[model samples]
Each structure stands twice: as structure tokens, then as C-alpha cells.
Target: MHELVVTPLGERRLVLRQGSSKALQLPKARFEELRTSGSSAVPQWLADAVQARWGMDVTGRPVDDVLLLREAGPYAFSRATWELNLGCDYDCVMCYLGEKRFEGLDMDGKRKLLAVMRDAGVIWLQMTGGEPLIDPDFPKAYRIAYELGMQLEILSNGSRLHKSHILNLLRTYPPTKLTLSVYGATAETYDAVTRNRGAFHRFSRGLRMAIDAGLTLDLSLIIVRGNAHEADDMRAWASSLGLPFREYANISPTIHGGAETLPSQSPEYLTNRAPFTGCPAGVTFFHADPFGRASICKVGRDPNIDLIAEGVEGLVRLGGIAESLMLRTGGCSGCKLSGTCRVCRPMAKVFQEAKAPLENYCQHGSR
Candidate 1:
């Protein structure tokens, strides 16, 4: 494995070190030069920059030894998020996925789907799930993505992260980011929220194990009704770990258009969001479900294109799908308050489909 990766991201180019989000921008001409520089020694400037930035000395190394290039393709997507499976050990009520069904591609199908993603120009990939660590096929799939030259980020609940095998896998091929969601500060509250007894103990054990392994990690502090009282404790705990954390308070309807997760939202913790702006979901990135169904984003999953059947050619339709989903249509058509809308079009559509309260999503609430 090369110490550095150089990949084309849409029209942009980046030089990234594995296990780190920080990247150094490369000019398109410079990128192309390196791609064509076969058997050439590492450039003096690049070696110096890499040494200064990442403290890795690549002065006398061959170009191939130091840099791994992920070639761009005719296909459009530069980033993608793939669901390895929808199976979880702990059932969190506030999960965006309404039903945590154990379904998705088998090992063979997973390999094919990841290959398609790579050929389609997906340089940055996020492997997510109903708790990706619990999936039996996770280790191989994770390794596959890494070997494919995709910068990976794993979204996990941290329940099974303490497992020796799991840690070994992660330690061998570190992800660019490993984001774990923290439900509560205490064991009792944590188990109560996830409806899994002894979950907090396991969660703590996983954190310690991951830290001891010297793995890079980020925390998502899930602020919900059950854990709202312990908000300060959660923040303090994250600070104590010295890991960067982000708070998620505005719980949305599930991807299945169900209102189940909204009630768990903590009203006091709710933060006002900026007005809706245009998004580049299908244009720049897309979400792939367990079965390899590609959608504009996670929330806008319908009218999907099957990646297995169509391959990268399926992504051609995604731009149109994204365009159609973003337009103000149906009940929202001709709305004069669109400028003041809080959420994006796809998100609004999900809330509308769920029959969520008007006050939760609309400016023209019941008067």
C-alpha cells in the first residue's frame, strides 16, 4: 500500500494520506504529470511537501511507492456512501432507517458493487449501515473498499467495535475517518435508548480499544429525549477523550418516510438551521443502498437505479432524478415561502410523506 493517494475529485484533484482527512490540493496539470510519470522518482517538491505536511519522508521513493493514483473516468460521481447491510446489534429508536432489516448484497455482490463504485469515479466513499461493525461480511467488504483505492469512512454505533478481529481489521487498513455515534453518557441511559442491555459497557470498551490501537476517530453525539439530561456529560466525555465531536439534534423522519424518529428529538437541544440552499447530491455524489440501488441521496431514495443491473451507466439518470426531486412540486408547488424553507426539497418530501406535523416542516403551519 502506498503512503499517499492522489485521486481526481470531479474537476478538482487532491493528495491525501490514508487515515487523515487533511488533503493537499494538486493542480490538474501536476496531477496528470504524475499519472504519466512512470518509473520516475518522486518529485523533489512533492516529497518536500509530503514530508512537511504529514512528516513522511518519501524523498528517494519511486513515484508508485509513494503515491497511489485513482484514475478518473467518464462516469460522474466523485463521492458515494454505500450501505454494507442494514443489520444492527442495538436497535436505536432514532435511527433514520425505519426498519433495520438484515438485507443487502452478499459477499460476491458487495465486491462487484464496490468495483462499480470505483470505476464510476468514487474517490471518497463512506461505508455505513445499521451498525456496520455487526455485519459478518464487514471486514472483507471494508478491505475491498480500501484495496480499491477509495478513501473510506465508516459510520458505526460502536457496539461491536471492541471485537479483536474488528480492531485488527481497522488497524491494518485505517479509514480516512471512523465516525462512531454516542447515544448517552451513562450505561443505563445508553441501554434504555438503544433498547439493548449492557450496551454502554461495550461502547466504553470499544472506545478504549480503538484509542489504544491508535486509530483515528470522530464522535457523533446523538442528542435525543432520553439522553437530553446528560448532554453536558456527553460533551465532557468527548472532550476528555480529546476527540472532535459534532452534535446532531434535529432528528428527521426515517428514510422509509416514517415519523418514528422525530419524537425522540430533544426540543431544548434543537438548533435552528440555515435556509435551504441548492444541493449537489446526484451531480457530485450519490447514496447506494444495501442492494446497490443508487439514489440522489439517502433521504431521496425512490425512483432509484439498480447499480448491479446498469453499472455506472445507471448514474447518468441520477442527475435528472436529483433535478426532479429538488423542484417544488405536489403540495409544495407554487409555495411563496420556499425562500424561507428550512430543509432541502428531498428532506421536505420525506417529512411530507410521513405526514409529519405541519409545524415540523412547513412555514404555513396550521393557523
Candidate 2:
């Protein structure tokens, strides 16, 4: 038998190579021995993972391994998302859903969704829209989510949030986090991107209102070719406002509706590919549409496979979808991109339809 060895790649991640054709990964409690100077106490939590690959426990096991395999799998689904509406008041050329009402999950639909999420063990819920605040019953929906013991997040344009009722809700049932998409630093830049006149002022006021209300805030900046250089400017602005910033490569043009207004991904634009990695779709997280269909990603929803129809357990069973999409070529062999690619499959398909070795948009920073 080959000896077991450990390599510390990064602080949080440790690689345990057992000389088997396949690598055995031990994360968190699995690597406690290596962390504490190679102590010999076996981690009960990881015995399943170790025995599955090594065919033995810290001691030896005589029982059947298949029976043990049945008992272990990925973490429970901890988050649920609602893509509220496709309709948008602004026409940011890079806006993914575009300006149409591609779908709508009204109050009744949301209630059903809440129940489904709770049953699936989701304790975190997000309400997203062209602008969810535009929904008349937004506050009530948020309250219902709160009542269900789910931490909430609003993926919004941050314009209608100035309403007294909406602001009061922040003080009432604050979300776990709020992601505000800020387009530009200057009024012309912002108005041009959203294609809404006076929208800059409205969004600015709303953002300030959210800050004053003490809501945790995060800013998302869509980096388009025309707007790539502005990322730093947006970051500075967010910092000035005491908010954290994140950059998202604009995938609006690649998805269904936004295709008409923006250009498709070209080799030049593929410079931002997330380091090649396995598609972690069903493993790290699962994306479901407004109708509760399991999608490959937020931008790759197929109505044919409604997760609700399959039921929570059925959807959970498709966890291998992430592993199935992994392929390697050229310099990407043995690169970190192999595993990291799972997080950005939506953006990957935007450039080179899914199932192919394509570039991604979020590759600007190593994940």
C-alpha cells in the first residue's frame, strides 16, 4: 500500500494525496490531524469519506462500503432564491434579463416557493427582480420569509427602496445581505448604462437610505468591455460609502433576452474566464428558476426540468451534474481552474455554449 501524505496548498485548504489513481479530498474536520501537528485521533465526521476511498477506517472496517456510501453526501441545501420578475424599468444594455417580463412569480407562487424552500432545508432566501421593490407586495413577502425563519437578501436596482414602507422593513426584518447593482460613477455614465433618465439620483438616494437604515450592503458592478475600466471607479465609490464591492462580468448579452442588445462573447472578451475548474453546479449550489426548475445556472434555466416536479429529493439526487461538465485541454491540465470552473458555468456557456471548454467572465480575480 502507498503511504498517505499531506500538502498545505493554502491556509484554509489542505490537499491529502494517498497515491491512489484518484485523489481523496479532506476538508475542515477531515484534516484536523494535519492541523494539530499530525495528531492521530481519527475524525469521526470524515471516516466515511476516508473509508470510501481508502477502503478502511483509521482502524479497519469489515462491513460493506456501499451501505456506508448511502449514508453520506453533500451538505444540506441551505439557500433558496427567487428571480422575482423579468420586467425592468431600466434598460442597462448589459442587464441579463433585458427589459421584458419573461416570467413572473406572483404572491401565490412566492408562498408556494417559500414552503418548498423550507421543506428543502433552506434557511436563507433571496428575493430578486428586474426590481423586486416594484412588486406591490414586496414588504409582505419579505415578512413572510422572515416568519419562515429564512435570512433574506434583496437583489435589486435600489431605486424604489426610498419608500417609507420599504425603509421601515429594513428596520423591521433586515436581510442577511443586500446586493445593489451600481452601474457608473458619473450621472451620464450611470444613466447611459441603465438607460433611465434621472435614475442616477433615485438610485443614489435609495442607496444612501439603505445605508442609513443599517442594512448590510454589497455592491455589484457589471464589467462590460465598454465599462471595464470603470470597475476601479465603482470600487472606490463603494469604499467611500463604506460598502464592500464585487465585480461581475456582464453576462446579459449571452442569456436569452439580453442577447438582442449586447454582443456575444468573443475570444478577446474571454480574457476574464474563471480559472478552468469543474462545474460545481449541483454540488456547491443549485440554481432554480422562478418556477422551481433546476437550471444549470442563473443564466441557463430550462423549463423542462422543474426541480419541483422532480421534488426536493429528486433534485438533490442530481448532485453529479457539476462533475459531469468537467473537461481539460492544453495548458489548463492540472491547473486550479479544474475545480474552480464549477462556480462560473453560466458565464462559461455565454462564450462557448455549455459542455465545451470555453472562457468565463469572472476570471479577472482567482477564486
Candidate 3:
């Protein structure tokens, strides 16, 4: 379909993509206006802005409302995340994979998995890690996904990105964006957080090289007690490099069932709350682990269906399973803290000991 697709860009903005590559960014209010009016005529101001920024001439281009709304539909699985492998070169203290060995599909198996994803209507695919670049078959898999017309994203620690082979592959079939996880702004704090003596230098070098190569890059700060003090510095560093930056404070239990890296919630972070309305996991998005085991998300990793065996049909069937999993169960049903309870089914399963109003999560409870 040669129609514009709209996706949310954070809470305040929306991104519109047409065909395989062209895209335009619009403010939430302007996007709402277009959605409600269903007007084919593009406003002169918006058209000029798009042309000036993205160099797309949409002066009188007709916007396909039906296609746009269809993509924006709640049931659409337009985006998917693939954990390419659970292996990494660095052993960060806060690693979610924790000691999990890499068990991803081989080259042939990955191709089959990509075909299934394409059939399942995933247009935007994020290849993540332990370290996606370290996966031996990543280049071929990445090229295959690009060939299948999927917008690609890579999440890495910037260790192998500077390698000539890796740089060449990226140049050949560049991703829409590459997100690097920055632990700290300085070497001392970075090494302390990552526990790799020369990691900071390598990460800095690789990130600089990639930027110099003119690759689209972004940064995320993994906020934890050890590196939280450098949050401002990290943001400043990203800003100095003219790159986008985001910070994440919450830490879930590792895939290996270890909570050693789960940090104490800061008072400011603890004030934020999630609504009782169920999460958009299996409903709109899904995650496949290294071995092609599909789950709603990494944290809520129950009901792991083997996507390799069941294919896209199996992914469709996960909706019912997801609904079942969302039901409030023992110690969760009608709890006084339901309004503010951070515990979801998968999280309860992760920390079974804290099933009943986790003391650490409860703001009223003593820390």
C-alpha cells in the first residue's frame, strides 16, 4: 500500500512514514487535525516544514486516511523487537540478560524467522542484544530484513560498530537508527559500572567513529545507583555530540531470574505510576528472544511460544494467551494497592517472594 503510516513519537509528537523510506514528523495536535479531518490537501506550512527538513515535496500530495488510520489501529503489530543473541563482550553489572547463554537461531533459522515476522505485518524491526553486532550472523540477517522492506534499528554497546567489516555492512544497508547504551559520561564511572577496565575508551572510540561515518545514532543512559550521579553529564555529552538521549531508571529481573542488578527505586522515580489498563504487549507489540520464543515483552516473558515452529499463526494465537495472563490473580485481585500497584503478572512470576504488595515497590512501606 502506497499510503502514509503514522506512529507515535513519544507523547508529544507523531512520525509519518511513506513507502519504505520517506518520513515526516508532525506535532501531535497537527496530526490529530489531519486524522480527524481526513483531508487529502496538505497544509502549506506543514508541507514546507516537511520539505525543508526531510526534503520531501508534499505540496499537494494526497494523504490516504484509511491507510494511515489502519496502521495507527490498536491491533496492528507494526513494530517488533528481536533479541538477536544473549551474548556480549562486556559484563555490565546491570545487564538484564545476566548469565544467559546465547541460543539464537542460526543464519537459515533467522531467515525463516524474518519471513514469519514479515507475514505477521511487522514493518519496523529492532535488533537488540546482549550485543547484536557480536552475533556472527547479524550482517546477513540485517541485510535480509532490509531486503524484506522492514525499517531496521540496532541497539548496541558500541564495541564492534567501529570494525571495518561491521562499518562496511552498515554502510551497505544502513539501519534507520543505531542506539548505544551509555553507562556513564567519564571513564572512571563507566568502567566501574561496566566492570570492564578499557570499555569506556573502546565505547567512546567506536561511537565517535560511527558518528564520523555519518551514521544516524542515538544514546540511552542506563540509570542505576552507581551511575545515576552522572545523569546530567551523560545528557550533556550526548547533547555535545548533537545526538538524542534518553534515560531509563527501572530495572527488571534478569532473564536468568537474577535480581542482583535491580536497584532501589529513587523517590522521584517511585512517584510515577502505571495505569491499571493492561500494557500494550501482545495487543500491539511483541518480543522474540534469542531462540525465537515469542513473548509479550522481555519482562513479561511467560507463555513463550516457539515462533520458529508455529510461525505467524502462533503469534496471532498469543492474543488469547496474553488476555488470560492479564487477569488479576492471587494477592493481586482487588488489592487496596491495585490503583498504584506496580506488580503485573509477569513481574509477580519473576519475584514470587514479593507477590503480595512488594515492600520495595510500595511507597508507603518502609524502604
CA lDDT scores, all candidates in order:
0.88, 0.59, 0.74
RMSD of 2: 13.4
Question: Best-fitting candidate, measured by TM-score?
Answer: 1
Expressed as tens digits, the lDDT of each residue in 1-367 for candidate 1 is: 7878898877789998878778899888889899987778999888888888988888878898778898886767788998878878888888888788999988999999998998898988999987788888899998888877788899988888889999999998998888999999999899999999999999999999999999889999999999999999999999999999999998889887899888998988888678878877999899999999999888889889999999988889999999999988876888888888778888888888889987777656764
Q: Model 2, range 101-191, lDDT digits (tens) per residue?
A: 7465667866776666655655456778667787776787777766655557788888887888888987666677888888878787788
Cα displacement (angstroms), candidate 3, residue 177, comes to 2.1
Q: Pick out the ten consecutive residues of candidate 3 with the lowest summed lDDT.
A: 65-74
Model 3 C-alpha RMSD vs. true structure (Å) is: 6.8
167 in model 1: Cα distance from truth in Å? 1.3
| Alpha-carbon shift of residue 246 in model 3 (angstroms) | 1.5
List the RMSD of every prediction in angstroms: 1.8, 13.4, 6.8
Worst 10-residue lDDT window for candidate 1 reads: 358-367
In lDDT terms, how accurate is model 1?
0.88
